[model samples]
Target: MDSGAGTAVGEMFDEMPQEKRARIDAGGEDPPESSWAGLHADALGVVLRFLPCLADRARVRAVCRQWRDAARGRGVAPPLPLLVLPRFRFASLTPGGVLSAARRAWMPPGLDAGNACCVGSSDAWVVGAGQAGGECFIVNAFSHEVRRLPHLGTYDCSLRKVALSASPESAPDWIAVAFMIRWSRPELALWRPGMRSWRVCHHALFAGHIDIAFYQGKLYMLWKFTPCLFAFELGDDEHGVTISRMKDCFIEKLLPTTLGSTHELSCNMVEWHGRLLLIIRYYGGYQARHRVKVKVFVMDLSTNPSVLTEIHSFGSDCIFIGSGGCKSFPAGQHGGVEGDLIYFGPDHYNPHDAFVYSMRDGRTGPIFKPLPCVTHASERNLGFPVWLFPKE
Candidate 1:
């Protein structure tokens, strides 16, 4: 681990150290030397929770009825998402950085991680809308299930980004929202259970570099151009989708970079605790790698102007923003992943564009610095690196 990496607080993760290891037998079967089925329910639950690999945990649940019941008792809170690398290699984000000896993340059995362009991920679900005329679907990693969604014919434009309101494991009412860009036409595509087809609407608010996020009871879109926000409420009746401007589309705050500067800015909106955050990333113009700068702001609706106020610290919690999904994560919940930081996953052609931003001293560093397992050699056109979270 890098000495300059970070401090570890695995204890705050739960009732025990964050790094828990289980003696996962081959094929998830109990050893013949002991009666695995005879173990206490709580004891079995602890082992199931500690399993480093999601596939192993899923297999453990299939061992027997007793094991399945134990697996139902999940963790206290949503653990940090697994950093899904190119070729489906999964690593855990820790205080020491990405670490994974098991180095595995579960996905739908047939889903091709290499060719698939995943739009968004939340809880345990990953949503993908590939080529325009191709298939679009939502797959559950833990359950190993996939649901097909509607796709436009000859549209020739794929979904740019997507966000989920909740995980499928939780309930059937979760919603999936996508930013659809077809030629010069931009719109919002939405779907939920029982919907025959996606409910979409063409709107000018979809223009500019936009990222969508679901918070509270409404969906929000942040336009990277002037840094404006648009909120929408989904309806099942003739309303279709109700769209409104947040604070009437206020632009009180602007990107930090000034004109004549060879830099680029990208923004993402996420919900942290009860606060909605907008994290703007600035990098060199030529490439995603550069003197990277990150700034976070909390949406202040109480104010008259309702501006995005810049925040210096994230306390102990941290933020993860990328093509897969953007959100605020609790402190030290997975491995040694510390807080007061921001993990970046820019979807540049460069697969190694990912990095970490520390709010403590305001600096950028390698995301895989502590772990030497990642060697992005021979990897090409590996779209967005995904962050796969657990299914609760």
Candidate 2:
């Protein structure tokens, strides 16, 4: 932890409401002989539902022996994903998309808010770097743990995206992959824990915008506006990290379509239930207000030349897509409806309205009303909103 960041966090804590500060200090203490301690575990579970944030629930568990036992037996349902706003503040959205009060997150020391922006997130960890250069680190949002990384060192291009093979909890085996745009082509880089520097790989075929995902120990890359797919096998030896390109795969014929008269096409890839999914997003109109659309396809790499099939139904899975990374979660597990629904939230365009799109019916509508706190005046300074799952 950086000393400055620690001090800042302590100051935030000190400024908390007196009632909240009391709860933190007393650990929600109650009379030892209070009858509330005799409440049944099932009833306690019902009470816990009202506290959505994990940190809030954790404090409730400390209220009494019975509550603690109930919390241990049946943990609180996972809270709705949080939106990471600027200055380390987290904003929550109701299932209906209404924005709630924002809470400040503990910032690690030396993380300069003015120059740093989060590039990627996975398993509750965020990867952020300084815009001017020399600052790169991984912050475990849940635990406020910080692990510094080697500087990118004049890479000559801005990092466009990043993906982690596994959670920081996985330790030594975890791998970090970063994608950069250089000379109108995608450049891939890899960094593992304890490595003094990142390994850059310049592939001839990595042209245009690209999305990368790690599935079953291999890195998969998909270029936008094209049906071609590339796979790379990653390894380590005395020579450090190695990336070897595998055979190329192609999707069925589907030419890129223009968004009205303009030519803006973006695609992203995600792994769900051992399968790879590709999503293409189309945007149209001017900067003030634009129309957005999406197309989804699933790829089967086991076939001789690989097969890309248009998917109509997602079945029991739902996908959360944003600039951070596209992720699939079991709908039932996350209190979401199953079968081909795509959820879109705030992104680079500063569209604070959230929507749910149905592939089954080909209809799209607003899922949540615009958040009150996210106004036009504050939009420019805000970071891209992403779906953040709670730490297990």
All candidates' TM-scores?
0.75, 0.76
Give the 10-residue window scoring lowest on summed lDDT in candidate 1: 9-18
- Whole-model lDDT for model 1 versus the true structure? 0.62
lDDT digits (tens) for residues 159-180 of candidate 1: 6677778876676787777776
Candidate 2, residue 264: CA error in Å? 4.7
Alpha-carbon local distance difference test for all models = 0.62, 0.63
Q: Count the backbone clashes (under 3 Å) in each candidate.
A: 4, 0
Q: Highest lDDT among the candidates is held by which one?
A: 2
